[model samples]
Target: MSPRKSVADTRRTRERIIDRSVAIASVDGLEGLTIGRLATDLGMSKAGVLGHFGTKEALQLAALDGASAIFMRLVWEPAADAAPGLTRLTAVLEAWNRYLETERGAFPGGCLFTTAAVEFDARTGAVRDAVARLYRFWRRRLVAELRIAVARGELPATADPEQLAYELIGAYLALNQAIQLERDSAAPDRTRRAVARLLAAG
Candidate 1:
Protein backbone atom coordinates (compact mmCIF):
# COMPACT_ATOMS: atom_id res chain seq x y z
CA MET A 1 0.00 0.00 0.00
CA SER A 2 1.14 3.57 -0.61
CA PRO A 3 2.19 5.60 2.39
CA ARG A 4 -0.45 8.07 3.58
CA LYS A 5 0.12 11.80 3.35
CA SER A 6 -0.30 14.03 6.40
CA VAL A 7 -3.64 15.84 6.62
CA ALA A 8 -2.07 19.25 5.91
CA ASP A 9 -0.16 17.85 2.95
CA THR A 10 -3.27 16.17 1.62
CA ARG A 11 -5.29 19.39 1.92
CA ARG A 12 -2.63 21.47 0.17
CA THR A 13 -2.38 18.93 -2.65
CA ARG A 14 -6.14 18.77 -3.08
CA GLU A 15 -6.40 22.57 -3.17
CA ARG A 16 -3.68 22.74 -5.81
CA ILE A 17 -5.52 20.22 -7.95
CA ILE A 18 -8.82 22.05 -7.59
CA ASP A 19 -7.19 25.37 -8.43
CA ARG A 20 -5.73 23.93 -11.62
CA SER A 21 -9.06 22.35 -12.46
CA VAL A 22 -10.82 25.70 -12.17
CA ALA A 23 -8.28 27.38 -14.45
CA ILE A 24 -8.53 24.64 -17.08
CA ALA A 25 -12.30 24.28 -16.91
CA SER A 26 -12.83 28.04 -17.19
CA VAL A 27 -11.10 28.15 -20.58
CA ASP A 28 -12.02 24.67 -21.85
CA GLY A 29 -15.55 24.40 -20.43
CA LEU A 30 -16.38 21.90 -17.73
CA GLU A 31 -17.12 19.19 -20.27
CA GLY A 32 -13.57 19.47 -21.57
CA LEU A 33 -11.96 18.76 -18.22
CA THR A 34 -10.14 15.45 -17.88
CA ILE A 35 -8.49 13.76 -14.93
CA GLY A 36 -5.51 12.90 -17.08
CA ARG A 37 -5.00 16.54 -18.06
CA LEU A 38 -5.31 17.65 -14.47
CA ALA A 39 -2.82 15.04 -13.27
CA THR A 40 -0.45 15.96 -16.06
CA ASP A 41 -0.63 19.67 -15.22
CA LEU A 42 -0.08 19.04 -11.53
CA GLY A 43 2.67 16.48 -12.09
CA MET A 44 0.64 13.97 -10.13
CA SER A 45 -0.83 10.61 -11.01
CA LYS A 46 -4.32 10.27 -12.42
CA ALA A 47 -5.04 8.13 -9.38
CA GLY A 48 -4.23 11.08 -7.15
CA VAL A 49 -6.70 13.28 -8.99
CA LEU A 50 -9.35 10.61 -8.85
CA GLY A 51 -8.65 10.02 -5.19
CA HIS A 52 -9.44 13.66 -4.41
CA PHE A 53 -12.68 14.05 -6.41
CA GLY A 54 -13.74 10.47 -7.16
CA THR A 55 -15.24 11.52 -10.53
CA LYS A 56 -15.33 14.28 -13.11
CA GLU A 57 -18.74 15.53 -12.03
CA ALA A 58 -17.54 15.72 -8.47
CA LEU A 59 -14.55 17.72 -9.56
CA GLN A 60 -16.77 20.04 -11.57
CA LEU A 61 -18.97 20.66 -8.56
CA ALA A 62 -15.96 21.32 -6.36
CA ALA A 63 -14.61 23.76 -8.92
CA LEU A 64 -17.96 25.54 -8.96
CA ASP A 65 -17.87 25.88 -5.19
CA GLY A 66 -14.33 27.20 -5.31
CA ALA A 67 -15.27 29.75 -7.94
CA SER A 68 -18.28 30.85 -5.90
CA ALA A 69 -16.12 31.40 -2.83
CA ILE A 70 -13.69 33.48 -4.82
CA PHE A 71 -16.51 35.56 -6.25
CA MET A 72 -17.95 36.26 -2.83
CA ARG A 73 -14.59 37.34 -1.53
CA LEU A 74 -13.52 39.53 -4.42
CA VAL A 75 -16.92 40.69 -5.68
CA TRP A 76 -19.54 40.50 -2.97
CA GLU A 77 -17.63 41.22 0.24
CA PRO A 78 -15.96 44.42 -0.88
CA ALA A 79 -19.20 45.93 -2.13
CA ALA A 80 -20.91 44.94 1.10
CA ASP A 81 -18.61 47.20 3.06
CA ALA A 82 -20.10 50.34 1.55
CA ALA A 83 -23.08 52.21 3.02
CA PRO A 84 -26.32 50.31 2.44
CA GLY A 85 -27.86 52.48 -0.24
CA LEU A 86 -27.17 53.58 -3.78
CA THR A 87 -23.58 53.80 -2.69
CA ARG A 88 -23.56 50.14 -1.76
CA LEU A 89 -25.29 49.12 -4.96
CA THR A 90 -22.80 51.06 -7.03
CA ALA A 91 -19.98 49.61 -5.02
CA VAL A 92 -21.19 46.13 -5.81
CA LEU A 93 -21.15 46.82 -9.52
CA GLU A 94 -17.72 48.41 -9.35
CA ALA A 95 -16.38 45.57 -7.24
CA TRP A 96 -17.59 43.05 -9.80
CA ASN A 97 -15.79 44.88 -12.57
CA ARG A 98 -12.66 45.16 -10.49
CA TYR A 99 -12.78 41.45 -9.75
CA LEU A 100 -13.00 40.59 -13.44
CA GLU A 101 -10.21 42.95 -14.39
CA THR A 102 -7.84 42.11 -11.56
CA GLU A 103 -8.53 38.44 -11.00
CA ARG A 104 -7.78 37.40 -14.56
CA GLY A 105 -6.60 33.90 -13.76
CA ALA A 106 -9.07 33.39 -10.91
CA PHE A 107 -11.29 31.68 -13.42
CA PRO A 108 -9.81 30.75 -16.77
CA GLY A 109 -12.72 31.72 -19.04
CA GLY A 110 -14.93 33.74 -16.70
CA CYS A 111 -17.55 33.14 -14.04
CA LEU A 112 -17.95 29.42 -13.36
CA PHE A 113 -21.67 29.69 -12.66
CA THR A 114 -22.21 31.58 -15.89
CA THR A 115 -20.39 28.92 -17.91
CA ALA A 116 -22.07 26.02 -16.12
CA ALA A 117 -25.52 27.54 -16.48
CA VAL A 118 -25.17 27.66 -20.24
CA GLU A 119 -24.04 24.07 -20.26
CA PHE A 120 -26.61 22.69 -17.81
CA ASP A 121 -29.64 24.95 -18.21
CA ALA A 122 -31.58 22.41 -20.23
CA ARG A 123 -30.46 19.46 -18.18
CA THR A 124 -32.22 18.22 -15.07
CA GLY A 125 -30.44 17.04 -11.94
CA ALA A 126 -28.34 18.10 -8.99
CA VAL A 127 -25.90 20.21 -10.95
CA ARG A 128 -28.65 22.14 -12.67
CA ASP A 129 -30.43 22.63 -9.37
CA ALA A 130 -27.26 23.90 -7.77
CA VAL A 131 -26.77 26.46 -10.51
CA ALA A 132 -30.37 27.56 -10.30
CA ARG A 133 -30.09 28.03 -6.56
CA LEU A 134 -27.01 30.18 -6.98
CA TYR A 135 -28.77 32.40 -9.51
CA ARG A 136 -31.71 32.86 -7.19
CA PHE A 137 -29.44 33.64 -4.27
CA TRP A 138 -27.54 36.30 -6.17
CA ARG A 139 -30.71 37.88 -7.51
CA ARG A 140 -32.22 38.01 -4.06
CA ARG A 141 -29.16 39.64 -2.62
CA LEU A 142 -29.17 42.34 -5.30
CA VAL A 143 -32.86 42.97 -4.89
CA ALA A 144 -32.54 43.24 -1.16
CA GLU A 145 -29.82 45.82 -1.50
CA LEU A 146 -31.96 47.84 -3.89
CA ARG A 147 -34.78 47.75 -1.44
CA ILE A 148 -32.49 49.09 1.24
CA ALA A 149 -31.46 51.90 -1.05
CA VAL A 150 -35.06 52.86 -1.59
CA ALA A 151 -35.76 52.89 2.10
CA ARG A 152 -32.70 55.00 2.72
CA GLY A 153 -33.86 57.67 0.19
CA GLU A 154 -31.09 56.93 -2.30
CA LEU A 155 -33.72 55.54 -4.68
CA PRO A 156 -37.25 56.64 -5.29
CA ALA A 157 -39.81 55.09 -3.03
CA THR A 158 -41.66 53.69 -6.02
CA ALA A 159 -38.54 52.04 -7.41
CA ASP A 160 -39.03 48.37 -8.03
CA PRO A 161 -36.16 46.49 -6.48
CA GLU A 162 -36.94 43.26 -8.29
CA GLN A 163 -36.98 44.89 -11.68
CA LEU A 164 -33.79 46.85 -11.01
CA ALA A 165 -32.07 43.72 -9.73
CA TYR A 166 -33.14 41.79 -12.81
CA GLU A 167 -31.86 44.49 -15.12
CA LEU A 168 -28.51 44.82 -13.36
CA ILE A 169 -27.91 41.07 -13.25
CA GLY A 170 -28.96 40.60 -16.88
CA ALA A 171 -26.76 43.42 -18.04
CA TYR A 172 -23.77 42.16 -16.09
CA LEU A 173 -24.28 38.64 -17.39
CA ALA A 174 -24.33 39.84 -20.97
CA LEU A 175 -21.23 41.95 -20.42
CA ASN A 176 -19.44 39.08 -18.74
CA GLN A 177 -20.08 36.83 -21.75
CA ALA A 178 -18.91 39.49 -24.14
CA ILE A 179 -15.72 40.16 -22.23
CA GLN A 180 -14.91 36.50 -21.90
CA LEU A 181 -15.36 35.81 -25.61
CA GLU A 182 -13.66 38.97 -26.82
CA ARG A 183 -11.11 39.45 -24.03
CA ASP A 184 -12.20 43.05 -23.63
CA SER A 185 -11.35 44.74 -20.36
CA ALA A 186 -13.60 47.70 -21.16
CA ALA A 187 -16.74 45.60 -21.06
CA PRO A 188 -16.98 45.85 -17.30
CA ASP A 189 -16.49 49.59 -17.42
CA ARG A 190 -19.40 49.82 -19.85
CA THR A 191 -21.44 47.70 -17.49
CA ARG A 192 -20.59 49.99 -14.57
CA ARG A 193 -21.81 52.97 -16.54
CA ALA A 194 -25.04 51.24 -17.44
CA VAL A 195 -25.58 50.28 -13.83
CA ALA A 196 -24.95 53.86 -12.73
CA ARG A 197 -27.50 55.12 -15.22
CA LEU A 198 -30.07 52.65 -14.02
CA LEU A 199 -29.49 53.63 -10.41
CA ALA A 200 -29.79 57.28 -11.31
CA ALA A 201 -33.04 56.58 -13.10
CA GLY A 202 -34.40 54.92 -9.98
Candidate 2:
Protein backbone atom coordinates (compact mmCIF):
# COMPACT_ATOMS: atom_id res chain seq x y z
CA MET A 1 0.00 0.00 0.00
CA SER A 2 0.99 3.62 -0.50
CA PRO A 3 2.38 5.41 2.56
CA ARG A 4 -0.80 7.48 2.91
CA LYS A 5 -3.01 4.38 2.77
CA SER A 6 -0.75 2.63 5.26
CA VAL A 7 -1.04 5.54 7.68
CA ALA A 8 -4.82 5.59 7.34
CA ASP A 9 -5.05 1.88 8.00
CA THR A 10 -2.79 2.22 11.03
CA ARG A 11 -5.01 4.96 12.43
CA ARG A 12 -8.08 2.79 11.95
CA THR A 13 -6.33 -0.10 13.67
CA ARG A 14 -5.39 2.10 16.61
CA GLU A 15 -9.02 3.17 16.97
CA ARG A 16 -10.16 -0.43 16.86
CA ILE A 17 -7.69 -1.28 19.60
CA ILE A 18 -8.92 1.58 21.74
CA ASP A 19 -12.54 0.55 21.22
CA ARG A 20 -11.85 -3.02 22.26
CA SER A 21 -9.76 -1.89 25.19
CA VAL A 22 -12.62 0.26 26.46
CA ALA A 23 -15.05 -2.63 26.22
CA ILE A 24 -12.70 -4.92 28.12
CA ALA A 25 -11.83 -2.29 30.69
CA SER A 26 -15.50 -1.76 31.29
CA VAL A 27 -16.04 -5.44 32.01
CA ASP A 28 -12.78 -5.81 33.79
CA GLY A 29 -10.91 -2.92 35.37
CA LEU A 30 -8.30 -0.85 33.59
CA GLU A 31 -5.72 -3.00 35.32
CA GLY A 32 -7.12 -5.95 33.43
CA LEU A 33 -6.04 -4.48 30.12
CA THR A 34 -2.77 -6.13 29.05
CA ILE A 35 -1.07 -6.02 25.71
CA GLY A 36 -0.97 -9.77 25.54
CA ARG A 37 -4.68 -10.17 26.26
CA LEU A 38 -5.61 -7.50 23.73
CA ALA A 39 -3.44 -9.09 21.11
CA THR A 40 -4.99 -12.49 21.72
CA ASP A 41 -8.49 -11.08 21.55
CA LEU A 42 -7.80 -9.03 18.42
CA GLY A 43 -5.69 -11.65 16.64
CA MET A 44 -2.70 -9.32 16.55
CA SER A 45 0.79 -9.93 17.82
CA LYS A 46 1.85 -8.51 21.16
CA ALA A 47 4.44 -6.40 19.39
CA GLY A 48 1.77 -5.05 17.05
CA VAL A 49 -0.50 -3.97 19.90
CA LEU A 50 2.39 -2.55 21.91
CA GLY A 51 3.59 -0.70 18.83
CA HIS A 52 0.31 1.23 18.74
CA PHE A 53 0.27 2.37 22.38
CA GLY A 54 3.93 2.04 23.52
CA THR A 55 2.87 1.40 27.11
CA LYS A 56 0.02 0.07 29.19
CA GLU A 57 -0.51 3.53 30.59
CA ALA A 58 -0.99 4.90 27.11
CA LEU A 59 -3.48 2.17 26.26
CA GLN A 60 -5.45 2.80 29.45
CA LEU A 61 -5.52 6.52 28.76
CA ALA A 62 -6.69 5.94 25.24
CA ALA A 63 -9.41 3.61 26.48
CA LEU A 64 -10.60 6.21 28.94
CA ASP A 65 -10.73 8.85 26.21
CA GLY A 66 -12.58 6.51 23.90
CA ALA A 67 -15.12 5.65 26.57
CA SER A 68 -15.61 9.32 27.37
CA ALA A 69 -16.35 10.05 23.75
CA ILE A 70 -18.88 7.21 23.56
CA PHE A 71 -20.48 8.44 26.78
CA MET A 72 -20.83 12.02 25.54
CA ARG A 73 -22.36 10.79 22.33
CA LEU A 74 -24.76 8.45 24.08
CA VAL A 75 -25.86 10.61 27.03
CA TRP A 76 -25.07 14.25 26.37
CA GLU A 77 -25.49 14.83 22.63
CA PRO A 78 -29.11 13.78 22.59
CA ALA A 79 -29.98 16.49 25.11
CA ALA A 80 -27.73 19.15 23.61
CA ASP A 81 -30.50 20.96 21.70
CA ALA A 82 -32.93 21.25 24.61
CA ALA A 83 -33.44 24.64 26.25
CA PRO A 84 -30.61 25.26 28.69
CA GLY A 85 -32.36 24.87 32.03
CA LEU A 86 -34.46 22.25 33.78
CA THR A 87 -35.72 20.92 30.46
CA ARG A 88 -32.21 20.31 29.24
CA LEU A 89 -31.15 18.84 32.57
CA THR A 90 -34.09 16.49 32.57
CA ALA A 91 -33.35 15.46 29.01
CA VAL A 92 -29.76 14.74 29.94
CA LEU A 93 -30.74 12.66 32.94
CA GLU A 94 -33.32 10.70 30.99
CA ALA A 95 -30.87 10.15 28.21
CA TRP A 96 -28.41 8.77 30.74
CA ASN A 97 -30.96 6.31 32.09
CA ARG A 98 -31.71 5.11 28.58
CA TYR A 99 -28.04 4.74 27.82
CA LEU A 100 -27.48 2.73 30.99
CA GLU A 101 -30.36 0.42 30.26
CA THR A 102 -29.85 0.07 26.52
CA GLU A 103 -26.18 0.62 25.73
CA ARG A 104 -24.96 -2.67 27.11
CA GLY A 105 -22.52 -3.22 24.28
CA ALA A 106 -20.27 -0.32 25.21
CA PHE A 107 -20.42 -1.01 28.94
CA PRO A 108 -20.83 -4.71 29.41
CA GLY A 109 -19.92 -4.64 33.11
CA GLY A 110 -21.83 -1.43 33.90
CA CYS A 111 -20.54 2.17 34.01
CA LEU A 112 -16.83 2.25 33.24
CA PHE A 113 -16.28 5.23 35.55
CA THR A 114 -18.05 3.47 38.36
CA THR A 115 -15.86 0.41 37.95
CA ALA A 116 -12.72 2.49 37.68
CA ALA A 117 -13.67 4.55 40.69
CA VAL A 118 -13.82 1.49 42.90
CA GLU A 119 -10.64 0.08 41.44
CA PHE A 120 -8.52 3.20 41.66
CA ASP A 121 -10.04 5.06 44.57
CA ALA A 122 -7.11 4.33 46.84
CA ARG A 123 -4.45 4.31 44.17
CA THR A 124 -2.54 7.31 42.89
CA GLY A 125 -1.16 7.78 39.41
CA ALA A 126 -2.03 9.05 35.99
CA VAL A 127 -4.90 6.57 35.75
CA ARG A 128 -6.46 7.72 38.99
CA ASP A 129 -5.98 11.33 38.02
CA ALA A 130 -7.69 10.74 34.70
CA VAL A 131 -10.65 9.04 36.38
CA ALA A 132 -11.00 11.87 38.89
CA ARG A 133 -10.86 14.40 36.09
CA LEU A 134 -13.65 12.65 34.24
CA TYR A 135 -15.78 12.64 37.37
CA ARG A 136 -15.13 16.31 37.95
CA PHE A 137 -16.06 17.10 34.37
CA TRP A 138 -19.34 15.23 34.69
CA ARG A 139 -20.16 16.92 37.98
CA ARG A 140 -19.35 20.31 36.54
CA ARG A 141 -21.67 19.73 33.65
CA LEU A 142 -24.54 18.95 36.01
CA VAL A 143 -23.71 21.94 38.19
CA ALA A 144 -23.85 24.22 35.17
CA GLU A 145 -27.32 22.99 34.31
CA LEU A 146 -28.46 23.35 37.88
CA ARG A 147 -27.17 26.88 37.98
CA ILE A 148 -29.07 27.65 34.82
CA ALA A 149 -32.21 26.22 36.31
CA VAL A 150 -31.81 28.31 39.43
CA ALA A 151 -31.17 31.44 37.41
CA ARG A 152 -34.25 30.77 35.27
CA GLY A 153 -36.41 30.37 38.38
CA GLU A 154 -37.21 26.78 37.49
CA LEU A 155 -35.57 25.92 40.81
CA PRO A 156 -35.81 27.92 43.99
CA ALA A 157 -33.33 30.73 44.44
CA THR A 158 -32.32 29.00 47.65
CA ALA A 159 -31.49 25.78 45.85
CA ASP A 160 -27.87 24.71 46.10
CA PRO A 161 -26.56 23.54 42.75
CA GLU A 162 -23.75 21.54 44.28
CA GLN A 163 -26.09 19.73 46.61
CA LEU A 164 -28.51 18.99 43.79
CA ALA A 165 -25.68 17.66 41.67
CA TYR A 166 -24.61 15.41 44.52
CA GLU A 167 -28.10 13.95 44.79
CA LEU A 168 -28.23 13.32 41.04
CA ILE A 169 -24.88 11.57 41.13
CA GLY A 170 -25.99 9.44 44.05
CA ALA A 171 -29.10 8.41 42.18
CA TYR A 172 -27.02 7.16 39.29
CA LEU A 173 -24.65 5.31 41.60
CA ALA A 174 -27.60 3.67 43.28
CA LEU A 175 -29.04 2.68 39.93
CA ASN A 176 -25.80 1.00 38.92
CA GLN A 177 -25.59 -0.89 42.20
CA ALA A 178 -29.17 -2.00 41.96
CA ILE A 179 -28.83 -3.30 38.42
CA GLN A 180 -25.43 -4.88 38.85
CA LEU A 181 -25.56 -6.22 42.39
CA GLU A 182 -29.16 -6.89 43.23
CA ARG A 183 -30.28 -7.87 39.75
CA ASP A 184 -33.09 -5.42 40.13
CA SER A 185 -35.45 -4.88 37.25
CA ALA A 186 -37.20 -1.90 38.88
CA ALA A 187 -34.11 0.14 39.63
CA PRO A 188 -34.41 2.35 36.59
CA ASP A 189 -38.04 3.16 37.33
CA ARG A 190 -37.19 3.89 40.94
CA THR A 191 -34.32 6.13 39.89
CA ARG A 192 -36.58 8.03 37.50
CA ARG A 193 -39.07 8.59 40.27
CA ALA A 194 -36.36 9.76 42.64
CA VAL A 195 -35.04 12.20 40.05
CA ALA A 196 -38.57 13.50 39.45
CA ARG A 197 -39.09 14.07 43.13
CA LEU A 198 -35.75 15.81 43.46
CA LEU A 199 -36.65 18.18 40.66
CA ALA A 200 -40.17 18.74 42.00
CA ALA A 201 -38.82 19.64 45.39
CA GLY A 202 -36.41 22.10 43.90
Candidate 3:
Protein backbone atom coordinates (compact mmCIF):
# COMPACT_ATOMS: atom_id res chain seq x y z
CA MET A 1 0.00 0.00 0.00
CA SER A 2 1.20 3.57 -0.72
CA PRO A 3 2.12 5.72 2.27
CA ARG A 4 -0.37 8.43 3.15
CA LYS A 5 0.70 12.00 2.60
CA SER A 6 1.41 14.23 5.62
CA VAL A 7 -0.56 17.42 6.22
CA ALA A 8 2.46 19.52 5.28
CA ASP A 9 2.98 17.48 2.14
CA THR A 10 -0.64 17.98 1.14
CA ARG A 11 -0.42 21.71 1.77
CA ARG A 12 2.74 21.96 -0.30
CA THR A 13 1.11 20.10 -3.16
CA ARG A 14 -1.86 22.47 -3.02
CA GLU A 15 0.39 25.52 -3.17
CA ARG A 16 2.24 24.07 -6.15
CA ILE A 17 -1.01 23.47 -7.94
CA ILE A 18 -2.21 27.02 -7.20
CA ASP A 19 1.09 28.49 -8.42
CA ARG A 20 0.81 26.68 -11.73
CA SER A 21 -2.83 27.66 -12.07
CA VAL A 22 -2.08 31.35 -11.59
CA ALA A 23 0.73 31.26 -14.13
CA ILE A 24 -1.37 29.48 -16.72
CA ALA A 25 -4.40 31.72 -16.13
CA SER A 26 -2.20 34.75 -16.70
CA VAL A 27 -1.17 33.55 -20.17
CA ASP A 28 -4.43 31.91 -21.08
CA GLY A 29 -7.75 33.11 -19.69
CA LEU A 30 -9.39 31.18 -16.86
CA GLU A 31 -11.47 29.39 -19.48
CA GLY A 32 -8.23 28.03 -20.88
CA LEU A 33 -7.53 26.32 -17.58
CA THR A 34 -8.42 22.62 -17.51
CA ILE A 35 -7.64 19.61 -15.39
CA GLY A 36 -6.26 17.62 -18.32
CA ARG A 37 -3.80 20.34 -19.30
CA LEU A 38 -2.70 20.88 -15.71
CA ALA A 39 -2.12 17.17 -15.22
CA THR A 40 -0.10 17.05 -18.41
CA ASP A 41 1.95 20.10 -17.44
CA LEU A 42 2.57 19.00 -13.87
CA GLY A 43 3.11 15.30 -14.62
CA MET A 44 0.34 14.28 -12.28
CA SER A 45 -2.70 12.20 -12.95
CA LYS A 46 -6.00 13.98 -13.52
CA ALA A 47 -7.21 12.27 -10.39
CA GLY A 48 -4.36 13.66 -8.38
CA VAL A 49 -5.17 17.23 -9.48
CA LEU A 50 -8.85 16.78 -8.81
CA GLY A 51 -8.14 15.39 -5.37
CA HIS A 52 -7.15 18.84 -4.16
CA PHE A 53 -9.91 21.01 -5.61
CA GLY A 54 -12.70 18.45 -6.15
CA THR A 55 -13.71 20.23 -9.37
CA LYS A 56 -12.39 22.38 -12.22
CA GLU A 57 -14.33 25.52 -11.26
CA ALA A 58 -12.96 25.37 -7.75
CA LEU A 59 -9.45 25.25 -9.13
CA GLN A 60 -10.13 28.32 -11.25
CA LEU A 61 -11.36 30.21 -8.21
CA ALA A 62 -8.29 29.16 -6.29
CA ALA A 63 -6.15 30.54 -9.08
CA LEU A 64 -7.90 33.88 -8.86
CA ASP A 65 -7.24 34.01 -5.14
CA GLY A 66 -3.61 33.09 -5.73
CA ALA A 67 -3.20 35.82 -8.31
CA SER A 68 -4.70 38.39 -5.95
CA ALA A 69 -2.27 37.36 -3.24
CA ILE A 70 0.68 37.74 -5.57
CA PHE A 71 -0.52 41.09 -6.89
CA MET A 72 -0.81 42.54 -3.39
CA ARG A 73 2.59 41.26 -2.36
CA LEU A 74 4.36 42.75 -5.36
CA VAL A 75 2.57 46.06 -5.69
CA TRP A 76 1.26 47.16 -2.31
CA GLU A 77 3.39 45.54 0.37
CA PRO A 78 6.54 47.20 -0.96
CA ALA A 79 5.03 50.60 -0.27
CA ALA A 80 3.99 49.81 3.29
CA ASP A 81 6.61 52.10 4.75
CA ALA A 82 5.77 55.17 2.69
CA ALA A 83 3.85 58.02 4.32
CA PRO A 84 0.16 57.73 3.53
CA GLY A 85 -1.18 60.17 0.93
CA LEU A 86 0.59 61.18 -2.26
CA THR A 87 3.87 59.61 -1.23
CA ARG A 88 2.29 56.22 -0.55
CA LEU A 89 0.16 56.47 -3.68
CA THR A 90 3.17 57.34 -5.83
CA ALA A 91 5.18 54.50 -4.32
CA VAL A 92 2.34 52.09 -4.97
CA LEU A 93 2.08 53.20 -8.61
CA GLU A 94 5.82 52.83 -9.14
CA ALA A 95 5.69 49.36 -7.64
CA TRP A 96 2.72 48.55 -9.86
CA ASN A 97 4.64 49.62 -12.98
CA ARG A 98 7.56 47.46 -11.91
CA TYR A 99 5.20 44.53 -11.37
CA LEU A 100 4.07 44.71 -15.01
CA GLU A 101 7.64 44.94 -16.27
CA THR A 102 9.39 42.41 -14.03
CA GLU A 103 6.90 39.81 -12.82
CA ARG A 104 7.43 37.58 -15.84
CA GLY A 105 8.02 34.46 -13.80
CA ALA A 106 4.83 34.93 -11.81
CA PHE A 107 2.69 36.13 -14.75
CA PRO A 108 4.11 35.46 -18.19
CA GLY A 109 1.34 36.97 -20.36
CA GLY A 110 0.33 39.86 -18.05
CA CYS A 111 -1.82 40.53 -15.03
CA LEU A 112 -4.24 37.65 -14.53
CA PHE A 113 -6.91 39.90 -13.02
CA THR A 114 -6.73 42.14 -16.09
CA THR A 115 -6.83 39.13 -18.39
CA ALA A 116 -9.82 37.71 -16.49
CA ALA A 117 -11.64 41.04 -16.83
CA VAL A 118 -11.46 40.85 -20.61
CA GLU A 119 -12.43 37.22 -20.69
CA PHE A 120 -15.33 37.28 -18.24
CA ASP A 121 -16.70 40.80 -18.69
CA ALA A 122 -19.59 39.64 -20.84
CA ARG A 123 -20.20 36.39 -19.04
CA THR A 124 -22.25 35.81 -15.92
CA GLY A 125 -20.92 33.27 -13.46
CA ALA A 126 -19.09 32.80 -10.22
CA VAL A 127 -15.82 33.45 -12.04
CA ARG A 128 -17.01 36.76 -13.43
CA ASP A 129 -18.20 37.85 -10.00
CA ALA A 130 -14.87 36.92 -8.45
CA VAL A 131 -12.98 38.93 -11.10
CA ALA A 132 -15.18 41.94 -10.50
CA ARG A 133 -14.58 41.73 -6.76
CA LEU A 134 -10.81 41.89 -7.18
CA TYR A 135 -11.09 44.96 -9.40
CA ARG A 136 -13.44 46.73 -7.01
CA PHE A 137 -11.10 46.03 -4.11
CA TRP A 138 -8.24 47.67 -5.99
CA ARG A 139 -10.27 50.71 -7.00
CA ARG A 140 -11.39 51.24 -3.41
CA ARG A 141 -7.81 51.08 -2.24
CA LEU A 142 -6.79 53.76 -4.73
CA VAL A 143 -9.71 55.96 -3.80
CA ALA A 144 -8.68 55.80 -0.15
CA GLU A 145 -5.20 56.96 -1.07
CA LEU A 146 -6.54 59.75 -3.25
CA ARG A 147 -8.74 60.97 -0.40
CA ILE A 148 -5.66 61.23 1.79
CA ALA A 149 -3.77 63.09 -0.92
CA VAL A 150 -6.54 65.67 -1.20
CA ALA A 151 -6.71 66.06 2.56
CA ARG A 152 -2.93 66.62 2.71
CA GLY A 153 -3.10 69.29 0.02
CA GLU A 154 -0.96 67.11 -2.25
CA LEU A 155 -3.95 67.36 -4.49
CA PRO A 156 -6.24 70.37 -4.67
CA ALA A 157 -9.37 70.63 -2.51
CA THR A 158 -11.49 70.56 -5.66
CA ALA A 159 -10.07 67.19 -6.76
CA ASP A 160 -12.48 64.29 -6.92
CA PRO A 161 -10.95 61.24 -5.29
CA GLU A 162 -13.33 58.87 -7.02
CA GLN A 163 -12.59 60.26 -10.48
CA LEU A 164 -8.88 60.35 -9.75
CA ALA A 165 -8.98 56.76 -8.60
CA TYR A 166 -10.71 55.84 -11.86
CA GLU A 167 -8.00 57.51 -13.90
CA LEU A 168 -5.19 56.03 -11.84
CA ILE A 169 -6.54 52.53 -12.30
CA GLY A 170 -7.05 53.28 -15.99
CA ALA A 171 -3.42 54.34 -16.25
CA TYR A 172 -2.22 51.00 -14.85
CA LEU A 173 -4.44 49.09 -17.23
CA ALA A 174 -3.04 51.05 -20.15
CA LEU A 175 0.46 50.34 -18.89
CA ASN A 176 -0.32 46.63 -18.86
CA GLN A 177 -1.67 46.75 -22.44
CA ALA A 178 1.24 48.82 -23.69
CA ILE A 179 3.67 46.24 -22.34
CA GLN A 180 1.73 43.07 -23.20
CA LEU A 181 0.00 44.05 -26.49
CA GLU A 182 2.08 46.79 -28.10
CA ARG A 183 5.40 45.46 -26.78
CA ASP A 184 6.30 49.09 -26.33
CA SER A 185 9.93 49.42 -25.26
CA ALA A 186 9.14 52.78 -23.68
CA ALA A 187 5.93 51.75 -21.99
CA PRO A 188 7.16 52.57 -18.49
CA ASP A 189 8.38 56.00 -19.48
CA ARG A 190 5.15 56.84 -21.22
CA THR A 191 3.12 55.65 -18.25
CA ARG A 192 5.17 57.71 -15.82
CA ARG A 193 4.73 60.81 -17.98
CA ALA A 194 1.01 60.21 -18.16
CA VAL A 195 0.74 59.74 -14.40
CA ALA A 196 2.70 62.96 -13.82
CA ARG A 197 0.32 64.84 -16.07
CA LEU A 198 -2.64 63.39 -14.22
CA LEU A 199 -1.25 64.43 -10.86
CA ALA A 200 -0.41 67.93 -12.06
CA ALA A 201 -3.93 68.58 -13.25
CA GLY A 202 -6.11 70.68 -10.92
Name the top lDDT candidate: 2
The 0-to-1 C-alpha lDDT of every candidate, in the order given, reads: 0.83, 0.93, 0.91
Candidate that beats the other on lDDT, 1 or 3, i.e. the better one: 3
Q: Write the per-residue lDDT of candidate 1 for residues 1-202, one digit (tens) a residue.
A: 3345577788899899878877887778777789999989999999989999898888888887777788888888987778887788778888887776667687857777788889889998777887898889989989988998999898999999999999998887888777878877678778878888899898
| Among all candidates shown, the one with the greatest TM-score | 2
Better of 1 and 2 by lDDT: 2
Badly placed stretches (over 4 Å) of model 1 are 1-5
Clash pairs detected, candidate 2: none
Model 2: number of backbone collisions: 0
For candidate 2, write residues 18-123 as lDDT tens digits.
9899889988899999999999999999999999989999999999999999999999999999999899999999998987777789888888989999999999
C-alpha TM-score for every candidate: 0.91, 0.98, 0.96
Superposition error at 86 for model 2 (Å): 0.5
Model 1 has an lDDT value of 0.83
